[model samples]
Target: MRKRIGLLLGCLIIISIFTSISVSAMTAEEIIKKRDSNEYIKTAKAESEMTIVSGNRRITKTMVSYIEGDNGLTIFTNPRDRGTKFLKRDDDLWMFFPEAEDLVKISGHMLNQGMMGSDFSYQDMMESDKLTELYKFELIGEEKIEGRNCYVLEGIAIEGKKVSYYRRKSWVDKERFVGLKEELYAQSGRLLKAMKVNKVEEIEGRWYPMESVMEDKLRKGSRTEFVIKSIEFNPKIPAGTFTLENLK
Candidate 1:
């Protein structure tokens, strides 16, 4: 009986050591990779609403967006902004004015401006690259956001990469691996924008943010609430949807 008890204790000790090793071996890159796997989609069609809030004033806009690889097209469908479109192909962005019947290319400093008077910039909407491609991430520590445990990570832009925010801090849910909050910063370490997730839903076996808010740090009492009404992942997209010709 004594020998049997000793052998059982030895087995339990070994199991505990192995479990601790596995947990401690998780790297920052692996964490980001898991997050990308859960959030990134090759193609998707989404209907969304954006509400811009400034002080006591609020304006809401409805839009339909198609995303495939690195290209995207968004069209406003609401009565007020009907027919307005934005197209992103490769590194270029173009906007269409339905009333003026004009197509304008967005570049330089204009890319940093708000998208349709919202807190989200044209550059923010155009972000299609994976976090791994644009930044080098380091595991900073762990924190709790909204009562959920999260893995804190800081990402600095990779050299020569053209990214709107030079640095970013993200709080990723430890269980679902979805980002709960993120802070965008300029090269000078000034906070540019902050995003917080209000709701998350399971869609097609993946966790997705259904509602979120983006706040412009430079603007006082201004924020944008973004809600995804519907989304279909890996949806069939018609050809020429991202072309400039389609923008007009």
Candidate 2:
């Protein structure tokens, strides 16, 4: 009987180990929760240097942007550019163009257009929610990406969704749910662009993507790079931080 008891315990140990491995192989969405209820959401702030190139020429624009959670975003460029330059909330759409001096509401149909003629759309440039909220994630498998063992997850937008990426392929670190690189595909099944998050900085003991480069797979020789020079978290933002009246 004692020998049988030992054999039973051994079997249980092996089962536990197998269970652990199975959970480890789960998709990134299984690991992280949406930031909406999370108390510790990181905010991004800093000077932005954007370099745009269509062909042989390049245009550089310097701006400042602030992101509060998944909704509050303020992008300021060109001191003389009018409008609040602040987008505080996002429901079904978003608005504002600093240079245009007027606010234009985005239509659900226009969400597919290239933002500023670059690879990323206006929606792509904005803050994003956790994977589980916006995507139905699945671990397709693993592969070596840039010498890193990454879990390749495929995300499909939920049916009847208003605004979303049709299909996305993300390579996430086994240890970190945040993706190191991502590819967005259009609703028509065309590869729109490739986004590479090159550098990550540990600020205040939190990891943040410091440098992001996006290439337009559809438009040749066009790219945009986001460089974060400085970051301040949880600053005292005003209640009316982004009122339309300020645009005047």
Top lDDT prediction, candidate number: 1
lDDT of candidate 1 over 145-179, digit per residue (tens): 99998989999999998878899999999899998
RMSD of each: 3.0, 5.4
lDDT of residue 88 for candidate 2: 47
**Full-model lDDT for every candidate:** 0.92, 0.64
* TM-score of predicted structure 1: 0.90
Candidate 2: which pairs clash? Answer: none
Model 2 per-residue lDDT tens digits across residues 1-248: 99999999999999999986886756456633421223135565666666667778776656666655654655656454323354645543355765565676655657667665555566664536655666777777777767766777788887876445688887765544446788888789998888887876666755666788888888888888877777777666655545555433
Q: Per-prediction TM-score, please?
A: 0.90, 0.75
- Candidate of highest TM-score: 1
Query: Cα deviation of 248 in candidate 2 (Å)?
Result: 2.6
Predicted structure 1: lDDT:
0.92
